[model samples]
Target chain A: MMEPSTDKAFINLINQNLGIAYKVSQFYFDDAENRQDAIQEMMYQLWKSYPSFDGRSKFSTWMYKVCLNTALTYLKSNKRNKNEPLQENHYHLPSEPENNKEEELRLLELAIGQLSSLNKAIVLLYLDGFEYSEISEVTGLSKSNVSVRLVRIRRELELKIKQKLNR
Target chain B: MDHLEIMRNQWQGSGKHAEFTPFQENEFSTLIKKQMKKQNHIIGRYFWGTFLFHILIYALMGHVLIKYGIVSSDQLVLTLSLFGIALTFPFTAKLMIEFKKLAQVQRGSIGVSTIKSQVEIRYGILSRYFRFKKLYDYFLIPIHCAIGAVLSFHIFVPGSFSYVSFPIISVFVISLASCWYAIRSENRTYFKLPLEELKGILGDFDKK
Candidate 1:
């Protein structure tokens, strides 16, 4: 078995990929606890499988696959869907920013979380600088399918942002 | 700027979300180590279980053969029993490697969806071995028992025929029940309605 990397190497990798965990968790979960649980689970799965990643793919690409797969399966099978929603008292979403850009960003996070798992994958890949071919490779979708879904995602987010802004 | 452009910068340079505070960093690494240790313990437990189970099976077979006087104490019942026990070693080693790989891949504690998606992609290969394990549990034991039943009946109870029906019927019933339990375990959650109206409860959070 391949030994774990030295602490310096491991820390470097963690610092690089940690954002992937946060973004993926944010996309899949609305509640902070769920997000944390999802992140922890993904990390657990990644550590479990990290050694055999034979450098064929970029490390980030492999990391994306590991994170997305873990989150999707967890969201699909988890019993948390049945838990009562947090009362309005539970979460302290920071006060809404006065600036339009920051408010939009905040709303975008919430809206994106509402997307279906597949759409979230498309959006995340697109936002992360993946071209159509690359997104297809990561997600097992055809390039044409990725393109078509991305159009739909853009339109959906536009409508959602407009409605939220007007309200 | 278009929404796409703004979102892209936020997504790409979203370093704040990705960056771990010192406390979170410590907690996550510790959790990963604990998970690895648990996996190693599970592998060791399975190894001993496989080794002990076959030994007990063979010992019982030996005792039966000796009591019936078909073979002396020094004689082996069948070389096949030893071969069957030998087969478990390869599986045990493969499981160890798999567990090791699983632990190493998760070193950073990334996120849940990515982890699950990776596992699903790899499930194609993993499922094959799991299927073999399920077969061993579901089919192998009863077949072994059936063989013992037939051999004892043929050798020691030539005149009695009542025991023959018990083995076939009992094995079939047990196998069916086990299959039913496995299917039920997979399907149990599909029946519940989830707490889908969280937005309504969160109320003004949606407005903000």
Candidate 2:
């Protein structure tokens, strides 16, 4: 299953783009165990899908697509997952942060938790600096749809975050 | 600042969204390999597990029919047994074919596809399997009672046919009805809900 040259190159690419898995899982899964499961699924998928990387697009772009796909289809185990509160410990997300940033992050996460998974993915991509076209390609939504949803998501998120903060 | 502005500012400034501790080469490969095995094994177990269960039931039924010596004279009873097996064949075939397709889909490079396509594909395979299972259960529940009725008449009563079979038939019918009720209730709650949730997700793509 491992070809030396190809395997070497795949591992290198995965190591470089490991952040994609961490970030997507961080948003999609709230708790530690589910995050771990999501990461495992994404990593396994990325490995299996390495040969299909046509190199036409940036490696990160392709990795986002795969990770997002894995996250969306991660339904079987998700049914069994408990919807728990966010925890601080993670491989990438900092264990400690400045007080304001921590408060903001917590409020942001709480508001984000109210979203459906698809909306969460869309919002995450937009916040992470993905253009409408890339978000469209990853989500299979039209560019116009992405634009429209982004507008709505921004409003909804602001309302929810404000409400949460006030409480 | 607005929510989007704050998010963009924090996400980009902190680089937290795009930062991770890199995995060592050995750790990366080993972890991926282990996950691959666990995931594949879990899915594989379901398919083979159900296959084993259905095979066992069929073997036991076949053995009982032969043991009763139905092959010698009771052509109608033998035909019914054969028909029951034949009816099950298509459903079993559909199950195997669908499971194979699902396995191929998992092993294929479908991970790079769009998220909508991925969810749709998984939902599609699962819903189809559920549909077939519901239909199979419908046929199986009654046929089971029918088999029990005929076997009781042939084996215990020791007669060519009589009004005495009516009591046995009543018992089997009641059992069959209860089985059907239980299955329908279970399917309505369990199967329909998840499929509806998936459909609801698809609906979100179209929401105004």
Candidate 3:
């Protein structure tokens, strides 16, 4: 049982870092309900594991590990059930009534959604500005593996975006 | 300049606009408690369900011993009950231990190695149990039936053991062959893909 003050502190911390949850959930789950469930599960795991935080790493780094792990587990379990259809390319078309920036961003999201789960994770971490070593640490991939994968992922994304632009 | 760079900037920028319903402290605490309760329910169900299944098996076996009274002596019944318990206890204990290990896995602050090890342990336990169960059904059940047949013939017919043995043996051979075929098909269809996926996940960590 957490003390009220500790609970409040934890709540504040989560509130501050909530964007990490949002971004990670959005990258993995296309639908709103699954995204919400993923976020809730992530927060619950973070709260359950909060007492183990030893201040050795940045809180965001620790949070990223928890979030990504939870998201991957969620995705796998959902796949087993095969209940909900995965929401691919659910974004508005480039011709929709949005500015070019929003359109391009939607295209990029759709393209990322097309990548394999592992590649999607690497690209998301890369976009979030994690160094290769940090990506390796979080993902359990060796640094060289992370480097090679990132180059391939970048080229894959470029090809995907180019195809989207042509369309 | 780069397409990827542009996407990253957009991610950082539009991420600010990702709307979420922020939870207050009390609400967050309530949510945490609710989730914890749900997790406890899932874990508790698995543990108790397994426990009750073993108990039910023992109860059924005891009922069989009482109803049949094949050996008119209480000592024989007690010995058989003890033997049944001894045979089943190992499997029950192992399942309980695996469930406990699964429950005790550190939730939030777990490292990659810890996660990988836990998953591997779970996969190993489950696949091993599946194979063991298949073998038990294929071999042990028929053997138990044969023993029961011989004992019943010895008690009731006194000299018809030879007569009963032939049919029992035939039944046993047919069932064993059929079970082997089923287990082989199940290994191919049910177990192979998931085990391969688990192995792939474990292999990711082994790369230098």
**Residue-level lDDT tens digits of model 2 in A62-134:** 8888887777665333543464434333224554556865666566766776687788889888888899999
How far does residue A121 in candidate 3 sit from its true spot (Å)? Answer: 1.8
* Chain B, per-candidate TM-score: 0.45, 0.76, 0.59
Candidates ranked by lDDT? 2, 3, 1
Native A-B contacts reproduced, model 1: 0.27
Off by over 4 Å in 1: A1-5, A29-34, A37-62, A73-111, A114-116, A128-134, A140-142, A155-167, B1-19, B22-32, B41-56, B69-121, B134-139, B148-159, B162-208
Query: DockQ of each candidate's interface versus the true one?
Result: 0.24, 0.47, 0.37
For residues A66-161, write the lDDT of model 3, one tens digit per residue.
787666653455345532333444553545746766655566676778775566777888888889988876776778988988777778877876
User: Lowest lDDT 10-mer window, candidate 3 chain B?
Assistant: B109-118
Could you tell which candidate, 1 or 3, scores higher by DockQ? 3
Q: What is the TM-score (0 to 1) of candidate 3?
A: 0.75
Error of 1 at A4 (Å): 4.6
Give me the runs in candidate 3 sitting further than 4 Å from their true place: A1-6, A83-89, A92-105, A163-167, B67-71, B74-82, B106-197, B203-208
Q: In candidate 3 chain A, what residue range of length 10 has the lowest lDDT sum?
A: A78-87
The digit string of per-residue lDDT tens for model 1 on A1-167 reads 33333355545685677888887876666578777777777776776666666667777887787787766554545635533322322334567677888777767666676676667777887888889987876776667877877787788888888898999
- lDDT tens per residue, model 2, B75-98: 655666666667667767888887
Residues B5-104, model 3: lDDT tens digits: 8877766676663566777987787777776776778668656855776787677556646755445664544555556656667767766665666566
